[model samples]
Target: MRIAQVCNVGEICGGTAACAWSITLAFPDVDHTVIFLSPPNSRTVEAFQHCQFHSAKSITDGMIRHLNVDLVILHNSTPNRVAQIRSTPSIQYHHSMGSRTAADVHLACSKWLHQRTPQSTQVLWQPTPIPIQRTDNPSRNAATSLRIGRICTPDDRKWPQSLIPLYERLAESFKNVEWEFIGAPGTLRESLQHACRGNARFITADVSARSRYWSWHALLYHHPTISESFGRTVAESMRCGTVPIVDRKGGFCEQIESGKNGFLCTNPDDFVAAIHQIQDRNHLSQLSQRAQDSSHEKCSLSIFRSRFLRILNQLSLGDSFDA
Candidate 1:
């Protein structure tokens, strides 16, 4: 089946771009094409050599005539694209928590996101892919606390500032723990650097290599976010065997089981206390193991492919279109 995945493929920092990449990679058997609205840079354009890339001006005509894409997957926050592709058999994947007017099959990454959308909209829950090699680490240290920093575009909805206080408290309250910030170097990194002033425990580094970005040593610390359709980083952290301390928001409340796979905090105080309590090696080790297990069960490539293909089959069977 020919599938056209449409989104802003130029964006490398946000979850939307990451989700698009993952989806494309997961379903390699189906002929895939990525339609980018903006002019893609050399790096972005080169990344998806396996899939056909088309510019916005020629996307519609190509989709209708040349490609004849059987299924079109539209990433959220692209209403104009959705309107343009409304006539095609499409599935809208909601990567953000907001209202959308157009889409054939509306898939929400979290329950919170689904609740906010129109009830009539066809919704499905699918977590973002967490690509990591499943390895049995015999030397996995339980006592060592690794606090991985987050990388986010400057958006109030993501609550980027929430990490400052949480990290500060972690540094002050614990000694063995180390914090590292990874992502594109920007105002957020500068802000985090300034916040870590006089506090040498917190370290910041811009991500240079994509391969090392999601390493097992990087334990993700995501504080409360105002709007998140699904926390992709949470799954990525778990896939790498890095424990995540997420604020109870959006789908995080549903994804994380406190004291099992990861820690969930209600507020800044609760967040700080949770970090302090899990400072021991034993707890971190257990959390890491549980995280790896949980990721394998829910976010593994095989499971993702099965669920996605099932959805596609259902859509195809129900629709009048012939294969």
Candidate 2:
């Protein structure tokens, strides 16, 4: 069947974009057209094959008409787009539904995200995939000291000012620990620079590419976030055999099993203390192994594709689609 995946493609360089790509790639037999809200970069556009791309403004006229789209999948709800496409068989896969009106079918990346939507909305759990292959890197097991890291896009909503004091304290208290901040360089430069100042143990790394970002030693540190639908980076870290020290917020609780896979911190002091506790080589290895195993079962590409296809079948759209 002909399907139209309508999304703000340009705005998505992270998990949401990866989810869209996974869906399209997984169902290759189905005719898929990506209706990008904004034009994607040359590299991003080249990634998808056998998929037609259209501008958001022309989506209503050009996309629906030309493609004769059987089903429209809305990633993020646009003001009138959902209503406009309501007549057609549409599914709204919410990265974060926010305050928008519910769609015909709502899919959430995590249980926390699913609960926020209307009860009438259909809930499908769609987690992000870990692109990096699992490796037996010697460095992952060799380190005895805790290596805490944070990844964000330099948004205040993500890396809040509250984390500044926490990060400073961790740097000061921990002797054998190192803190790394990875994201857009200049965006959080001032804040990160100020927080790490005089604390030679803190390192701020500019992550312009996914490869570079995932190359670090494991044991990610994510403080409590105010608003997050799902944390894909944490899962990705797990896939690379890196344990995550996440706050008890959003999908973090769902991803980690407290001491089983990784530590769940309630506050800044708890986060630091957890780090100190897991600094032992044996404990770190066990945690890393558990994390990798968890990623394989819950967030792997194969599992995501199989679960997604099964969901479509249960929705009775599987037979309708060519694949």
Candidate 3:
């Protein structure tokens, strides 16, 4: 079956774009096309060369009219595009496109997201593809330093802002732990860097935070201030067998069973307690194994293919896959 994946951002490597690209790579049998609304990044444009691409500055009526595909999957599409393609046999593959979006089917990445979305939505687990080249040792390498990491996006929406004081207290209290922030410079990073001004323990590297998942023994992402449509980074770290310390909110809460595969925190106090719980190497090792195992069970390629086909079957567009 011919499938078209539509997205707004093409240049930035955010979760939306990442999910769209992953779909293209996952399905080789089904004819796939990427319809990008914004000016696509050169790297991504080249990557999608194996398939077809239609990049435009705006989502126009002509662009909508030209998509001759059996199924249209909207992955982070603009409202205009959503409206333009409302008539097509389409489903929205979204993380945070809230209610009011009209579609034949709506696939949200997290249960919380699905719950908030219009009744048409269903939970669809996202799959992350292996990077083209092996990224820097994703696994923790330093024996002395208890490496901790999280994305410091420009907006500082990744984690709870209310936990800043507690985070500062911990950073100062623990000498052996290293904190790594891998996004645009933000106020929180600045504060953490200021609080830990004496040494390199407070690291602010502009690196692919996702690639460094394995390097971090644990991800402290408690108190997600903004409602996450899907917590891709949480699962990414879990896939690397890295335990995540996340709040009891968003999509992360759906995949995680507190004290089982990962730690689920209620607030800053609970978050700090959870961190201490996995301080022991043996205990941390057990959680890590379970995290990776859970990732494999929920987000593996085979499972992704199965879900993709199932959705197609529901649409009555089932074309057998070589997957």
Candidate 2: residue 226 lDDT (0-100): 63
lDDT per residue for candidate 2 within 179-277, as digits (tens), equals 566552454556655565543233332223333224455555555446567777777778777778877788878888988888778877777777776
State each model's CA lDDT, in order: 0.61, 0.63, 0.69
Q: Higher TM-score: candidate 2 or 3?
A: 3
Error of 3 at 278 (Å): 1.8
Q: How good is model 1 by TM-score?
A: 0.80
Ranking by lDDT: 3, 2, 1
Order the candidates by TM-score, highest first — what do you get? 3, 2, 1
Q: Model 1 Cα displacement at 226 (Å)?
A: 2.3
What number of backbone clashes does candidate 3 have, counting pairs of residues 3 or more apart or in separate chains? 4
Those runs of model 2 whose alpha carbons end farther than 4 Å from true positions after fitting are: 28-31, 46-51, 58-62, 86-88, 99-103, 119-122, 133-139, 142-146, 154-156, 184-187, 197-208, 212-225, 320-323
- What lDDT score is found at residue 299 in candidate 1? 75
Model 1 stretches with alpha carbons more than 4 Å out: 57-63, 84-87, 99-101, 119-145, 153-163, 197-225, 317-323
Each candidate's root-mean-square deviation in Å?
Answer: 4.4, 3.8, 3.1
TM-score of each predicted structure versus truth = 0.80, 0.81, 0.85
Clashes of 1: 2
What lDDT score is found at residue 322 in candidate 3?
Answer: 51
What's the C-alpha lDDT at position 57 in model 2? 50
